[model samples]
Target: MADYDNSRYTYAQVLAGTGYYMKDDKLRYSAGVKTMQTKLNTAGYDSGTPDGKFGGGTDTAVKSFQRAKSLTVDGKAGKATLTELDKTASGGGNASAEAKNLKKKFGSIISSFASKNSIGEDVLGGFILTESSGSGFVDGALKIRFENHIFLKAVPSASTTFKVEDKVHYYKKNGKWYKTHTGKQTSEYEAFNLAKNISENYAYYSISMGLPQIMGFNHKVTGYDTPKAMFTGFSKSEDKQMEGFCTFIVNYSSGSLLKACQSRDFTKMGQIYNGDGSTYGPKLKANAADYAKA
Candidate 1:
């Protein structure tokens, strides 16, 4: 397996730059390799979890994927093959510019969140987009991110706009592009839920000249009777507070979530947000389940 710790910095920092996200969803493009997949499968090559992630399993699968398709089986992603891969990714469906818009918006949202929340922009951005969508949600992107969790087979939501009524945080922990994970835990559900609450309700709006939605954030006070005494424009609305919390949620979900998955710590932040990881298994390792993803 190719072990490159460089998946950090280089991954997230790319988010700051526009046009970094894929125009099509990652799974959408990978599905395009069906022809290649069938060929490999016929030749006794294990395509390994056809969820659509181009990972070790996928790479191993690619040798067969490429060989079946009559291409060089070097196993590195390239343009000509990827272009064809994308064409078939949507399963013969067309990827309009609107989808690409979503990818860019998604990236921009994460990048902006890093700047606003003082989080590591590079790390956050890297988590923003993955190999799942052609480019995290860029124009023509076929991949869709439900919350912050990675999924190569992620499909575009019916409504591109974030709806208040949407369940929002129910993440799919299995059946992903790769075979890296297996199941979801209560904590994961909570993290995804809190993250959605923060993203859709708070961070999307609520601004106050850099302070955004903090009352005494710019002040050095020790409980001056009331919050108003320290700062005048503090919003008491829970929605406003949610925005503040959402900034951190994005930061956590985008970075910590990925790390947990890499190091098998998926349940860390979730426990911190849900209850206590010490009580429950610190990490809910992915097993043999439809939800399992790499």
Candidate 2:
């Protein structure tokens, strides 16, 4: 980041910048491209060898990174893409220390948020642990769980687009329609991207995001104008995700859920959050205990 010209990278509201690499450009070699390739590789996008060349592998990697980060899906290493790549690759993938780092970086914010919202601090920690494994991101991008059932119901066109008999995207499980490709970010987003082709708004609205695992349809209670806004904001930082989580806790069901959170009644919290009677109370309690020890 030091040797590279900042003018070449795009930051917020800065449009005079030049792109280091455009999508349609032919195979080219440069130190700038090499640096980007290195970062992309470090960020786990697999841009082939850092040969200082903008080739097909690098292009595909750039597009994958953009897709994961919720940036424009163009395969260009422009201002926004480069900037985010630098930030993401700056740190190593030390997942074992995720909980420690999460607390160390945002302990004050979480404590103050918990106090103000009358929620147990450990309860908040439990939610983060259970929802996102104490990290707001997965594989150098914001964590998301796409719901195919929600997507099918949210967008009428999706029902026709993906038939249950296909046994690929949709499947009937215990008399309920379920998404076959789910439970992992890569597979989930793959399905999500397919759904996005049908209806982008419904696609965004159907996913749960960040450490809080808050669904996009709850944007209004979380103080966002729309589901896309909530997705974008949550993708930027955990602080914004925390803000949305707190706001939603305070506003949802007229603060009754907040009362349950304060009382450490994770059964009620899970019932409200998951929409099923399968209370995650024991797991949440176990997570909180582990975080306390850590």
- Best-fitting candidate, scored by TM-score: 2
Q: Give lDDT tens digits, candidate 1, residues 1-294.
A: 343222222222332332121222233443434344443333234555444333555456544335434567676434444543433232334433433443344545544655665545333332222111222112321111223322111223512322222333333333221211122233333333333444532211121111122222222221234333322222333222223333434434345543443344424633643454432211121110101111
Residue-pair clash count for candidate 2: 1
Question: lDDT of all the models against the reference?
Answer: 0.33, 0.68
lDDT of 1: 0.33
lDDT for each residue of candidate 2 in 119-197, tens digit (9 for 90 to 100): 7776776566556545678887888877766877777666754444544566343456556566667766766677777
Off by more than 4 A, model 1: 1-59, 62-84, 87-99, 103-108, 116-255, 258-294
lDDT of 2 at 223: 88
Which consecutive 10 residues in model 1 have the weakest lDDT in total? Answer: 285-294
Clashes of each: 39, 1
